[model samples]
Target: MGLFPISVTVVEPGRARTGFRKTAAMRLGSDVGPHGGTPIGGLRAYLANPAAEPPG
Candidate 1:
């Protein structure tokens, strides 16, 4: 039997003075409730566990 290890690296750019907030605001609109947008934390967690089985 053999074992293999994997390493991952992520490079997120530093926050700059941009119109990102305005863009998100326009896209999200006034809907400030649950399920209004994608779950970023969950997505990152899933990405972290690359060996996990795919969701059914």
Candidate 2:
């Protein structure tokens, strides 16, 4: 019999242009201004459909 061990980790960037980040920044009274994240649905959408594109 044999066994194997594996380790995995996941990370999400902060201080970026993401909406979540923007909201936090706004709460802190920072000038988030009018910027956007990855666009559309963000990372989740991109990861789900890496080939997605905005409609024309």
TM-score between candidate 1 and the true structure: 0.32
**Top lDDT hit:** 1
**Count of clashing residue pairs in every prediction:** 0, 0
Native-vs-model 1 lDDT?
0.50
What lDDT is reached at residue 48 by model 1?
A: 44
Q: Which residue runs of candidate 2 sit more than 4 Å off their true CA positions?
A: 1-17, 31-56
The Cα local distance difference test for each model comes to 0.50, 0.42
TM-score of 2: 0.24
lDDT of 1 by residue, 1-56 (tens): 33867677999975454454445545655444565356844443344443543433
Query: Candidate 1, 19: how far from true, in Å?
Result: 0.5
- lDDT for each residue of candidate 2 in 1-56, tens digit (9 for 90 to 100): 33867666988754333355445434545322343253533534343442443332
| Worst ten in a row by lDDT for model 2 | 29-38
